[model samples]
Structure formats: C-alpha cells, structure tokens
Target: MKKLMNFKGLLLSGMMMLGMTAFAQDGASTTENYDQGFRLGFGLNGGVTTGDYFNFALGGDVRLQYDLSQRTSLTLTTGYTHLFGEDNVPDLGYIPAKAGFKAFVWGDRFYVLGEAGAGFAVTNDYNETTFLWAPGIGYANDVIDLSLRYEGANDFKTDQVALRIAYGFKL
Candidate 1:
C-alpha cells in the first residue's frame, strides 16, 4: 500500500540519518565515551488507553540515543503499538516514528524527555497518518531503562499513559 511504502521510506531515511550521525562523531579510540556517545535499546511497553474504545495498549520499540554531554542526549525511536478494543470493537494499531530529546534532571538516574513525529495507523480506520507527541520522565542505568510517558495521536484521536521497560547497551 502507498501508506506502507511511505512509512518504510521514512523509517529507512531516519536510520540512515542516525548512521551518518554515528560516523560524524569524533572518532575516539575508547568506547568509554558510550557514557557520552551512542547507545541502543529494545523496550517493551504496556499501559492503559485514555479513550473508552480501547482498554489496554501494548508495544515494542527500538531506541537509538546519542549523548551530547553528560546530562543531555538526542534520540530516534520507532515502534509498533496495538490498542485492544472494548467488546465488539475492532482493535487498532499504529507505528510510531519519533525524534526526541532527553536531559537528566537528577544525577545519572532520572531524566525528562519529549518527542514529536507521526503515527501511522495500521488499520486505516482512522487517517493513515497522524501527528503524534509524547512527554515523560524516566530512570536509566547502565543496563536497565524505565520510563512512564503520555503519548497522543491527533487524527487517530487516541492517547495512552504507558510504561516502558528496556535493556540498553553501548555500541
């Protein structure tokens, strides 16, 4: 479908941008800079939908983060989310592609993040693509990452409060 192709193109483009960024960074010898360089994570999300039509939501995502400094980073995230509908209603799902920023509000453990991008509806019941945004606070360490966020899609008229649990590692 046309929508799928568009989504694929966008996804591939974003990945290429991230890859180019990695190569553009300082060619440092030691990866001890992972503390301030590049990292990747796989996360699972579960949460309650804000609308009456759906009871719960679930998804998984891949996140790429590049730290600008000790307390700040830039991130690119892409994921799939499924909204489980109420009785007799059809479930709806979306793929989200976002770019975001994170800043540590506390020492290495606590941070706040915000993202904006598109949510492509899988079923096409809603518009094929919707504008989306998420804002949240979280905690992260060397191996584990956790966050609670509120995500909303405009044309889909859907939103949720979700928790993300993940394991992350340096490149």
Candidate 2:
C-alpha cells in the first residue's frame, strides 16, 4: 500500500510538471510589435447572457492603448451595451472607463489581457455604479479583431461572458 501511494504521488507530480512546461512554452511566443506607441481601435459585439435573466445584448467600444514595453501595455476602454427585453428589465446601458494590463503572444495579433475599471449608469432610472474586471483572449489582424472574455461586476455579484468583434485601423 505504501509503495502504491508513493508511485501515485510521483505520477501526479510528473503530470503537473509537464503541464507547467507546456504553459511556459506557450507563453514564450510573446513578442513586441509597434510597442511604445499609441494605438486606437473600435469594435462592436453582441451576445446573450444567462443567470438573473436570459437576455440578449449588443455593445460597442472604443479603446486607446499605450504599449509600455514588449510584454506589457496599458489600455483605456469606454463602451456601452444595450440588453434586450427579459423579465421587464428595461434595456440596460452603461458607460465604462477601464484601465488594465495586456500580455501578448504570437506577436501583437494574439494576447491575454485583464483589466479593472469603474462604470456609471447613464440612464436616469439606472443610477447604479459598479466595478468591472475581465480576462480575455484576443486576436487581431490588420483589418479586424475579436475577443472572448468573462466580465464580472461587483454591484450585482453578476458575471457574463462577452464576445467582442471590431473592425478598425491599426494606427
């Protein structure tokens, strides 16, 4: 029994080490492109959510990014989303101002990013304020970009999955 347990532990440790190595290798592909410069882009995305209510939403966002280094950047995002009818929860909207860090791999076109920021309600009926945070995987080409993210808000203890797609110039 003792030998069997020892062998199991060793096997688990070996698998863990292998997984770590794979992740590190994937992380090594990150490279710099157009770093230390300013980039502005805009995009639109629509999706559905489930939880408090099953609803559909569409949103547009604009972002300005400043690359502080090859592996790091700071971004500011402002955006609004409109949720469709569900449970009489009139279409909801928000304007979010966020700042976060981004890390890139496979050049500037693919990345892993996370950001935290605050948002305020724009409509009179929805004077609620909330903090937002998201971690996403993104891909961009010369003409188009897309991202998948999970967004969380503190006020409602709510979380949603977001899919964003945009077309913008890389200047």
Candidate 3:
C-alpha cells in the first residue's frame, strides 16, 4: 500500500510541474504557430523613382523563405517589374531574382530584410544586364506576409529607384 501511494504521488507531482511550466511559457511566447512550419509570400508595390530617369512603376514579387533559426530566415525572391512614364525614358519590364538575409524583429510578426544581386532586363533594344539592391520592411500574421521595398539598379551607366509592395503566403 505504501509503494502504491508513492507512485500516485509521483504521478501527481509530475502533472503539476508540467502545468506550471506551461503557464510560465505561455506569457513569453512570440509565435504561437512556430510549429506550423515553412513560409512563402508575394506582394505588389507602386512607387515613384528618383535617379538617372524619374518614373512611376509597379511591381509584383514572390518570395520563398525558410526559417534558419527561430526568428532568422533566408529568402529567395523574384519580381516582375514594369516602369513606364513619359519622363522616365527607358520604359522597362524585367524579371529580377534576389537571395538575401532576413530577420524578424518583433517576434515572428515583424521583419527587416535586404538583398544584393544581379538581374537581366527584357527590352526592345536588347536584354540588359543590371546589378540590383533591395531593402525592405515587413509584417506578418499567420499564413500571410506583406512588405514595402525600395529597389535600386545600375543598368550600364544609369541608376534608378522604385518602390514596391508585396504580399506572401506561407506554404
């Protein structure tokens, strides 16, 4: 009888400890869905440019991101961009791909990211090789992410800038 009572006491004690730990952990938790796993996203942005040519452009970008650490990630993004205006002479539609570093600032809900890469512009004169950079900020909820980005490029001798916004879904 004494042995049985000791076993029961141990079991009850273990359950109580688990309950206390869970209560303590709940208060400091950031992303409740960390176990949801993997993230993907897309977004659209419209902004004016200031550089060699000034113009208004719209772009749509898609991102595939993986959690490298609890709040740090790596992302690969590709965007289809179009810039057209009477003043902005080049008028371009190009596909750009970037690989960058991203880190979440306020838990998993907010982030800041930057990327540097190269791109090719599809144009009437010729396919142009360009170097590009992007820095952006983002917000996320479960399953969706959004961002506003500043994009810059050096095409031959001219440099240009554009603003873009995007939305992405986790998969």
Instruction: List the global CA lDDT of all models.
Output: 0.80, 0.67, 0.64
User: lDDT per residue, candidate 3, 1-171, as tens digits?
Assistant: 465447435644643453344334335555556653467777776776554454667778887888766566788888777766456366777788889877666555767777778777786564887887776667777665666655667673333334444555557
For residues 1-171, write the lDDT of model 1, one tens digit per residue.
Answer: 465447445644644453344334354434445456799999999998766688899999999999887667899999899988899878888899999988766556877787889988886465579888887778999989999887877676567879999999989
lDDT of 2 by residue, 1-171 (tens): 465447435644653453344335444434445346777889786776544643766789998878777655688888886656577666567787888766665555676677789877676477788997766768876667788766666673344667988775646
The global Cα lDDT (0 to 1) of model 3 is 0.64
Off by over 4 Å in 3: 1-37, 156-165
Best by lDDT: 1
Runs of candidate 1 with Cα error greater than 4 angstroms are 1-35, 124-127
Error of 1 at 29 (Å): 22
Number of backbone clashes in candidate 3: 10
For TM-score, candidate 1 versus 2, the one ahead is 1
TM-score of 2: 0.73
Worst ten-residue run, lDDT, model 3? 18-27
Total backbone collisions for each predicted model: 0, 0, 10
Candidate 1 clashing pairs, residues 3+ apart or interchain: none
